[model samples]
Target: MKWSEISIHTTNEAIEPISNILHEAGASGVVIEDPFELSKERVDRFGEIYQLNPDDYPDEGVIIKAYIPINSFLGETVEEIKDAINNLILFNIDIGKNSVTISEVNEEEWATAWKKYYNPVKISERFTIVPTWEDYTPVSSDELIIELDPGMAFGTGTHPTTVMCVQALERTVKKGDECIDVGTGTGVLSIAAAMLGSSKVTALDLDEVAVHSAILNIKLNKVNDVVSVAQNNLLDGISEQVDIVVANILAEVILRFTDDVAKVVKPGGYFIASGIIGQKKQQVKEAIEQVDFTIQETLVMEDWVAFIARKN
Candidate 1:
């Protein structure tokens, strides 16, 4: 079989939405090549390491690549993706250098191309995201490992937004606490919550593909007993209150459902919101506050932001 590789060159701010566009367009998988990965400092306490080739990355902006099966409707799909990406401008998202290019590759090449970019990296003090294909050992007895395949989903669980969410979970989750993870792509956060001793976790996603992928990841991490995967819109129709709620989605989407979030989170429980760009931080903060959530902490990493809010 043949596949078309669509590569989009854009800024870090546009990575999340653009990746969503590619997935919606029927991409089998997505790979991100950020120049920042080259200079970023890494700690290898376990001694297992991998080398990165400089030639595979862009010099400035990030390059997002997704594989689309070649078919009669391929051209139409690509155009729709481009249009949807252009539409992001109305939301005030910066789609810098939005240049897209396509190429052809055989099934064998496409299957292995994205694996080179993934490696075991500790995103937080207690959590390390390891690709299923890699072999990694923990350096400390308390280290938590999350195994993810991502498949056709939008996140590897190591993205800045996810990292912050997991970090917040580590700090807030208590033993036997009931938690909910909204837009739980790849089920990474849900698995993290389970590992942190949450008695039960409800992992929800609107996309069927994400729901299935997340379920697979939950089982891979052996957390299926604690995390339940479901297909549902953000906090809609959920009446039972949870001890903690975490969402790593676009700021605009977050704004649309802050009220629902407030309703489902128990008093004194926590809400961890992320996948927000720096420019939209204030807006999201205001929306959360409007729902009576007290802003507890705001975390920033590069151009992204995450907030930990408490319902008092």
Candidate 2:
């Protein structure tokens, strides 16, 4: 279960062509980390949480990683990968002129080593996230328990965005309210609203895996009767008005869906929007105004803000 991490360092200019090479080499996944996109404060924050080095810097560059399974053991692909590396140097070096660095990771101790990174996380005062392998018992005082394993999708309730959305749900959800969670990763927010006493909760995501995972997580939490998942975009298939709508997606997507999100909320219902960066707030604020929703409250955590707006 060990994995080989093939890293290619290239300028933004050559990224697309180099990515094609990695794909042809049968790599399972590729991740590009742009140094320019990786700000100093973000690196410091990541270092604080993951104990990672904050000093790694690349100018106008990105790190592309492709993971190779160890059991298949395709050593021959190394030559092909190397040829691709040399081609980057031979032809497309200047527009980007970014140097390439390559390395292989083969450690016996790292066979399926990602398990070490998985652990229980607490999401709220009444809720604790239990990994599938761990045993957890909620106190009689505890209100809800959510179970999940970090397999492939996002929204484990660990990220700052997810945490902010859940906290917003805590304050906004009331008894017997209808709620919709757009882009419901792991269905965490919908399930949270159900546990928080929402009468019915509907969660939707574009990813099929997220829909299935959310279902599994909902069943694990014994909220299956109240919470359900669907594959859709921004409540597209939904026909009824909901008392609360929560979307924890990127700022750009939020702007695109402002009207759609506003359409689904019943008059006077509240919308909790997250995943907005500092520089994009004014733009999002303008979009919200276009929908005639008044900003009820704003919460900021670590440079990210969630807008709690109510439809007029």
Candidate 3:
């Protein structure tokens, strides 16, 4: 089988949204080549090795690449992805140099090409994301490992937004707490919640593909007994109150259904909201406050922000 490689040249601010667009358009695997990573300072507290190639990245801006089967509908799908990306402008997102290109490759090339970008990285104090293909040894007795295949899902459990959410979960999730993970993606946060001692976890995602992926991942990490993966849109009709809720989604989506989130969270429970850009931090914070959630803490990494809010 052959695959089409769709590449988009955009800014860092547009990475999350544009990658999401590609995923929604039936792209199975997405790779981000950000030039900023070449010069960025990283503090690796837990001895994890990183293999980066300066030649693989662009000179400026970020390039997002996704692989989709070269099927009859590939043209239509690509056009829809472009339209969806253009729509991000309505949210006041800067999509600098939104140039898109396409190329073709064999299935073998597509299958192994993106693996080079993923490695074992300690994203939080206790949790480290290790791709299934890598052999990594834990550096600490208390270190937790999350094995992810990533596949074609939007979340690698390694993105800064996801990293912040898992880190916040490490700090907030108590033993035997009931947790709800909205837009669970790869179910990384739900697995983290379960690993952190949440007795029961509900992992929700509107995308059926994501639901399937999450279920597989939850099983892969042996957390299926504690985590349940389901296809649901945000927090819409969820009536059962949970002890904690975590959402690593776009800030605009958070603003749309924060009230619903507030409804499902038990009193004094915590809400960990992430996938917010730095520029939209205040807006998301104000929206969460409007839903009667008191901001407990705000975490920022690079240009992304995560908020831990509590219901009073």
**TM-score list, all predictions:** 0.76, 0.72, 0.77
Instruction: Tell me the tens digit of each residue's lDDT in model 1 across 108-220.
Output: 98767677779987888898899999999988999999999989888987677988898899889999999999999899999999999999999999999999999999999
- Number of clashes recorded per candidate: 0, 0, 1
Ordered by TM-score, highest first, the candidates read 3, 1, 2
- Whole-model lDDT values for every prediction: 0.91, 0.77, 0.90
Q: Which candidate is the best by TM-score?
A: 3
Candidate 3's displacement at residue 290, Å, is 1.8
Stretches of candidate 3 off by over 4 Å are 3-37, 43-49, 55-104
For residue 124, model 1's alpha carbon misses the true position, in angstroms, by: 0.7
Highest lDDT: which candidate?
A: 1
- Residue 234 of model 2: what lDDT? 74
lDDT of 2 at 131: 76
List, residue by residue over 1-312, the lDDT tens digit for candidate 3: 998989999999999999888888887658899888888878665566586789989998999999888999998998898898899999999999999999999998876877887888898889999888899898889999999877777877878899899989988999999999999988899999999999999999999889999999899999999999889989877899999999999999999998898899999999999999999999999999998899989998889999999998
Deviating ranges (above 4 Å) for candidate 2: 1-65, 69-76, 83-112, 137-140
